[model samples]
Target: MTSGLQQKNSILILDFGSQYTQLIARRVRENKVYSTIVSHKITAEEIKKQAPKGLIFSGGPASVYDEKSPKCDKGIFKLGIPILGICYGQQLIAQYFGGKVRRTREREFGRQELFIDDHADFFSGLPGNITCWMSHGDYVSSLPKGFVSIAHTLSTPNAAFASRDRKVFGVQFHPEVVHTARGSEIISNFLYRICRCRPSWEMGAFIKDTVSHIRQLVGKDSVVCGLSGGVDSSVAAVLIHRAIGRQLRCIFVDNGLVRNREPEEIKTIFRANLHMNLDFVNAQNRFLKRLKGVTDPEVKRKTIGDEFIKVFEEEAKKIRRVKYLAQGTLYPDVIESVSATGSPSAKIKTHHNVGGLPEKMNLKLIEPLRELFKDEVRELAKQLGLPQEIIHRQPFPGPGLAIRIVGEVTPERLQVLRDADDIFVGEIRKAGLYNEVWQSFCVLLCIKSVGVMGDERTYENVIALRCVSSSDGMTADWVKLEPALLGKVSSRIINEVKGVNRVVYDISSKPPSTIEWE
Candidate 1:
């Protein structure tokens, strides 16, 4: 969704390059109130134009005293909106209001206990002591001019401060993270009790509004949607079809890089079950040819993305009068592409549909799910009456198996990884862990090792198994699969799939490592 279509009475979250900034937006949106994220550099006049009922300052990695640290316009405090500061945001508030802030000798990270001092509305209906997730090195040394300390921790004497009359609040801990127990409740208290925002936003409303918007935008023009048979694309195709039935046409490209039999399965499901106006393109040869000797991850992604676009362009020409191109670009894609918050976020890998899409394409872009998270898209899929299989299917990247293959994109490597991934997922489903994990896949590492098979010497490539548990794709932790299940998967892959000898599970989290290997 575009910034123009954001609902009124929304909360404006000023991002300061925090990794958890998106989580803050997710929490607010979960309360049924619309929320938008912008850079901390957003001026007061710009924020005033949005007319948000509340303002939130997100945590960041930079220190307030740093030379290049991000800061907000001081006039925002005069907007008369309820303002809540978190972590670095809390430091900004303190530093802005004549309070002292410095690097603490004792740093607070991970889970910590917070003791409430004077009960305030911000912590209403909560216990006196609660566990909170803390990730800050700097602490507020003194309270702001008109602020009173409302909570404290052993390390941070002023863990939370508030000025009820000014409608300003600051918390040293991150309530947006799940590690912070009662995190959602804290956000709800702020949304409902302080800001007085109405819980009026829902997926049903979004569908109705988006359909009307799409209808008005593409009155008589036909649109072509890129369908990957994943939840995001499928939902977008259905939603757009609902908007303009005959005007929407979906193109599913088999880029020779998907899982085994994925192309055939997708064709069957779309043609028979969903009954969509679909066209399937088998451009595997073209894709594999273009990626013949490519080894760089970014180069591989761009090559696949460009090839997909070319295929879509060719298909669009066959169809008559297609004026728009639709994609299932989600919020995480937008955030990672280039900070939606406008703050300086280190670019993670470039998603094929996000930054890899050609900017000079002939058709105008339509991304209905741009402002939504993955879970929200699933809910929308359910509202659209999509089949259970399509609704619950785990997310697959647009680059398909191209990214999953670590070093090179080859037919042999693709087949090997696909076979191994299928077995991995089949076992996950068999163990009743498929739906429990956010994403689970196997990557074919380029390196080879010596092994013993049938008492003889054998050399083959190693396969890495990656499974993560996450609320949104933004942040994730490795899923702790049972030892028996791991043993079964490893045994099955080593014995069944031909080129692999070793199986290793990745235990890294999202902060240091992304879900994808390449």
Candidate 2:
């Protein structure tokens, strides 16, 4: 979704480059109030134009005393809206209001106990003692004018302060993170009582508005959806079809990198169940030709992405008037491509649909699920009456099995990976753990290991099984499979699939290791 929408009664979060800035927005949205994240350097006029009912200053990494620290327009406080500052945001508020802030001798990095004071509406329904998540080195030394200490920890005396007259509040601990007990309740108090915001936002309303918006954007113009039989594209295609019924055409390209029988399954489902105009393109030779000797991950992604667009352009020529190209680009793709807060973050990897596309293309882009997380999209898919099979399908990268192979793109390697992956997933389903884990896949390693099979020395390729449980793809933890289950999978893979001998499970989490091997 674009940032230009004029959502009414929304909350504006001025991001100060915190890693948890997006979490703040997610928390606000969870409260059923629309929230948008913008750079801290946004001008006062822009804030006035958005006309938010509340303002939230997100936590940041920089100290407020630094000259280069990110700052918001001073005039924002004069907007007469309820304000809540978090972590570094609290320091900025204190410094702006004539309070002293200095680096503390000991930094509070993890969970800490907070002793609450008699602040009327700030801590309305909370107990005397609560746990909070704190990650800051600096603390407010003195209270600002007309503000009283609402809460404090052992080391941090002025942990939280509020000014009832000015409708301003500050908290040194992060209430957006799950580590803080009753964090949602505190945020709910701010939204419902302090900001006086109504809980009007829901997925149903979002669907209605997005459909209307899409219709308005593509007036009498045909749109083409690159359907990959995945949840994201399936939801996008169905939503766009709901808006412009006959003008939407779906193209399913089999690049020969997908799982077995995916193309035929997608065709049958879309045509028989959804009753939409669908086309199947067999460009496996085209994709494999361009990816003949490519070993670099980025090059493979770019080649696959560009080849998809070229194929789409060729198909668009056959259709009547295809002006817009629809994709199911989600919030994580945008966040990973470039930091949403305009801060410096390491580039994880390029999503084919997000960053690998060419600069210039024939079709304008239309992404309906851009602002949504994966779980939220699943909810939308369910609301739209999509079948359980599509709604609960495991997430597959846009580049398909190409990125799953570590070394190079070749027919022999692809077949080996495909067979092993099928067996792994089939076992997961048989164990009734398919829906329990977020993603379960097999990665074909480039190296080979020596093994004695039936008293014969043999060298064969090794495969790594990656199964992770995550609320969202941003962070994930490896799933701990039962020993019996693991043994079964290992035995089946080693016994069934040829050209491979070893099977191992990955135990790495997201921070040190990504879900995908590449």
Leading candidate by TM-score: 1
Which residue pairs show collisions in model 1?
none
TM-score per prediction, in order, is 0.96, 0.91
Q: What TM-score quantifies how close candidate 2 is to the native fold?
A: 0.91
**What is the overall TM-score of model 1 with all chains considered together?**
0.96
Once fitted onto the true fold, the runs of candidate 1 whose alpha carbons sit more than 4 angstroms away are 1-6, 106-108
Computed on alpha carbons, the lDDT of every model, listed in order, comes to 0.89, 0.88
Give the per-residue lDDT digits (tens) of candidate 1, residues 40-112. Answer: 9999999888888899999988999998999899999988989999999999999998999999887777789
Tens digits of lDDT, candidate 2, 1-518: 32333376689888787767777877888888888888888878898887788999998888999988887899987878899999988999999989999998987787899999874787889999899989999999988788889999999999999988889999999998776888888988899899988886678888888899999999999999999999999999999999999899999999999998898899888999999999999999999999999989989888999999999999999999789999999877777666766764456788899888899899999999887878888999999999999999999999999999988889999999999999999999999999999999999998999998999998998999999998768667899999998899899889889988999999998754778877
